[model samples]
Target: MASAVKDSRSGYGTLLRTPGAWTFLLPGFLARQPFAMLTIGIVLLVQSTTGSYGTAGAVSATTGVAMALFAPQGGKLADRFGQRAVLLPGVLVHAAGVAALITLALAHAPLWALLAVAVPTGASTPQVGPMVRARWAARLGAGPLMPTAAAFESVTDEFTFVVGPVLATALCTGIHPAAGLVAEAALTLAGGLLFAAQKRSQPAVHRPGSGERPRVSALSVPGVRVLIVAFLGIGAVFGGMQVSLTAFTQHIGQPGINGVLYGIFAGGNMLAGIACGAITWKVGPRRRLLVAYGLLALATTPLWAVTAVPLLGAVGLVVGLCIAPALITGYTLVETLVPATARTEAFTWLTGAVALGQAAAATSAGQLADGFGPSTGFLVPLAGTALACTVLLALRAHLLPRRSAGGAEAAAGHLPAQVSAGAEDRERELARA
Candidate 1:
């Protein structure tokens, strides 16, 4: 049924016609304002207070690790108790942690206080990404609307990264070192609360006290394991690329514009993501996903040979075009595979998988760059993408099953009734089409 979702009307304008789509997307945008700023803001905040970049890096990493480890738990809470219930408390805890961190920095408190608070800050992250994606899946069901929403979120991600770090850097240096962190806390509270208020769109939660463990965890589902692992590889590609791109720019003596070039790369993906959503895709989601991964694997290899800056930028654009499509398709596949009851957790695991891959690849690429050169570091993303392609290839039958009764069962999953209604609606819509 997911594979059957197609659109002859080829434009983003159609998506806005869904009633209250803007209501959901706008606050979702607001909810993300603090996330991009947090890591850099933490780094700057700690460094300013402690005069130790190492400590700053450590604290930031601690926050990230805590966030990663707890994300699934947060998702589980959202599944058991509605999104609003989970998000409201997350809003408070996250804001308080950030506020405490800022106050400690200003007060010149000990490093341990800063480190301790970072855990709650990360743990209490509102999980806006997963929540919003789940909401889209619930509202639109397994149709082109699914991919469009995914692409829109992907585009939003690009926009945040492009502007977020710049804004954080400016606030930290221009105002006070604590300014970005303060702003981050304020935005977190405002955005989180606003988003929670939109309770009408929230996905139905699994009831409490019916309390046998779920028949299948998100990871236990067929094809989900491969999805998580493939995402890990994709994440590594990103992490490795970040390090390699930095190295390449410095090699060319244009270290100053590394961010500019990265932005161009992201811009290419942003446009491609939108195009991928707007078109009527005849190819199955699995094929499109595999093709995108294969393209990324091939596109990144030339980075090892190219020495010119402009050529590198051009190649980066090519590589960038493949990423969002892969991500958009991946989310679509996950929607088809995961039962709606476990949806948020399934998506959170996907995010965690990527985070893990990025961390490992970033470390490896940094080492290779230090040992050999920056261009050599390019091998990391190339290798990562190849692995992703390999994983997708291995899971092809499971991930992209044929259109038969078995396929319908796989796509229908064991979703709860409230969630399954959306799937049935999509099927009826497809029949009309």
Candidate 2:
């Protein structure tokens, strides 16, 4: 047992020591927390204040759509200009939007006013988390540490989801919603700026040979298309999950219970992600990714059976078990499949797919919950997961990486100097793809 524990610790220790790894992971975690917090907080606060869940859902949906539409552009900017250049403007735009949200709420502005403000706020969304993940691909050269890095990113996402709502709920209810939004804005500013300050965190983009025209499209890549589908499916699940908590709360005749439920759901993802990161695996990446998706599908099934709020929260915790590992593995695969130059764009595409999924889910879930009832709305994600599973299976051949024949030679080639050369190769491949 002691030996096992030591082995586990040592494994994580190696990951922690990887150059530029911690720098990329930690700041993005901090930055992403506020994004999750503000999103949940604003929806709850608006719904509570205006006594109209529909309007709140609409605002949230709008945010999701805007995020989806603009994310690809954000990725392009990050790649072409630089992470710092792209990030600074995004931070400011997000901050400004949040300020508008706070002001409108405090001023008792009409619902339309809030919706209008939420659009730009979503557009100016930071690329910090996506950029950070891309940086890992550049730094680590994509292998064992890729899973660890992806797990780190997933856990951070889960952690934010867990804490964001709780903090937002407490602040909005305890103090003022405006105050909560302001605080979220501040964190975005600070975190985005801080994240940008780290020179090593920027993604390495290599310009191709003379007269080489820019790549026409990321969609041309078979791997990118597969990953995008997975992202969209997962995104739909995430968006539906958010709405489902509220649906569960309302169904239980205790609308306030969603905060607790969501917190539990996010909590499960956080713990599972951390544990997944700690484990060292010799299994092939394709097999690991398949298992992750399968677990996600299996874990989601029990969620529909939950009726009571407490039971709902408990079941959600169990459902969350597969989320982080699945996401981490998927992201790791994305890093392997996509080239370096298009890395940021690829990440953005991933984010956009998720945003589109989230938006679609939010709209559909909200309407279903408000019209037919919350129970059916809760089941939509289950169906979405089944769809996702089919997509994963169908796309498996293209999405999964092939086992390299060189074995030890391939493994050893992932060091620092190799990282630079690999990035250059990735750029050329991305251009061609």
Candidate 3:
């Protein structure tokens, strides 16, 4: 029975067998809903009310920067205290900020008022991505199945991205501009609180409580910086694509349907991530990363000519295919790079880098879209992909770990739930040492 489950296509069956999986995974998915909705919501709301794309972009950028600057500290706090300690308060603050933003936007508040409220709002993001992944890592150690789990999670994330924007737009266009953010505020409170409450699956907080030798920090590692920078470049691609797509939709006089097009963009990622989970990967992380980067560069360049909605959606689908697999590989690499103790913080740092890149791209791309045109803004994503490809090629070796990550995991006594005979020998040796 176990073997049959393990051999099942996609490995989701095996992944979900962990105790209390659904209890937490459901809320985690809901918490991630805002990841896609909030930005687009802000963009649409501020643009419509204030009649300034540049201001809209600037506000989004402020939120991104605030989130970027505080994410690591949030993770640090979670590591030191506990997930509940950090997350419970974080969610409420975030909900309040979103509510305030919506009310102020509807009232047509001053730009400075909106921007000031947005800073704290963005900073209040509850560290959803890292915390959820950390829970999975704790439940299923870093091993073969870990890849499948990451892939599945990536697929879920893609689905959230697909639905979030569509849902946000529906509420905004169907109901009111402020309605989308109202929903966001509700989800942040409900989903975040529920997710944090699932304490059973939460990873054990790792902190120096006493005179125990301090665990090695992820930042001190050599290759980690490179990986973070790589994530930054990738985030730039996403940020530019998002901002440009918004401009493109508005330019085409179909701003309401942009959500469907964006959803299609994520639909491809959802499909690819599902397939990626079903198959066992033979390629190492470094090689897979380069190939993914190559695909991103190739796929995004044609987006330059995407004047029509269908062409843009098709091209968006193509580019979307590369995102999930690349993110999966990056997650796997970051997990392997850090010690088990620092996994949450390490993961959040990757998000921080991505947020930072998104901030820069959104700010600049919005200006480009507003002044030069949406066509010019599209160049940012293509340029970002090209630069990321270049960086990955130049620093491939430097970004790779010096030692075997699997072996290190074994040495740390963090083997998977099921170990093959070949792995058993290594596990035994590590045990003896």
* TM-score of each predicted structure versus truth: 0.79, 0.84, 0.90
Cα lDDT tens digits, model 2, 1-433, are 0111111123566777887677766777778877676566666667667766566678778888898888888888777778888888789989999888877866778978988998998888886768877787777664556667777778877888888877776676667755567778888998888888887667665555576546434555687787777777777777788776776676668755677787888899899988978876544445566677777777778776677667777778877877776677777666555556677787788878777777677767777777877766666667766787788778766763323334322342222344434443443343333
Highest lDDT model number: 3
Candidate 3 lDDT, tens digit per residue, 1-433? 0111122234788788877889888999989888777877888788889877788888888888898888988877777677889999899999999988988988999889999999989899877888888888887775556777878888887898889888987887788877778888888898899898888888887656586557666677666777777778777776787788878888888887778887888888889888888876554555667788788878888886778788888998998898877877788776556666777788888888777778778878899988998877778777877887787777766554444445554344333323333333432343333
Candidate 2, which ten residues in sequence have the lowest lDDT sum?
1-10
Off by over 4 Å in 3: 1-10, 209-211, 404-433
lDDT of 2: 0.71
Report the lDDT tens digits of candidate 1 across residue range 1-433.
3555444343567666777777778888888877767766776677678755446655765676677678888888888788888889988999899988888888988878888988898888777888888888778765546667777777776676556655675687678988888888888899999999999988876663564434347877667788887888777666666556655665677654655666666677777787877777865566678778888889888878888778878988888787888888887777667776788988888877765565556556656776787788778788888987897887666673223243434444433444345545554454334
Error of 3 at 118 (Å): 1.3
Candidate 1 ranges beyond 4 A from true positions: 1-11, 40-61, 98-118, 169-183, 208-215, 243-256, 304-308, 366-377, 401-433
Better of 2 and 3 by lDDT: 3
Provide the RMSD of all predictions against the true structure, rounded to 1 decimal.
5.7, 6.3, 5.5
Residue 423 alpha-carbon offset, candidate 3, angstroms: 12
How many pairs collide in each candidate, listed in order?
A: 0, 0, 0
Candidate 2 TM-score, C-alpha based: 0.84
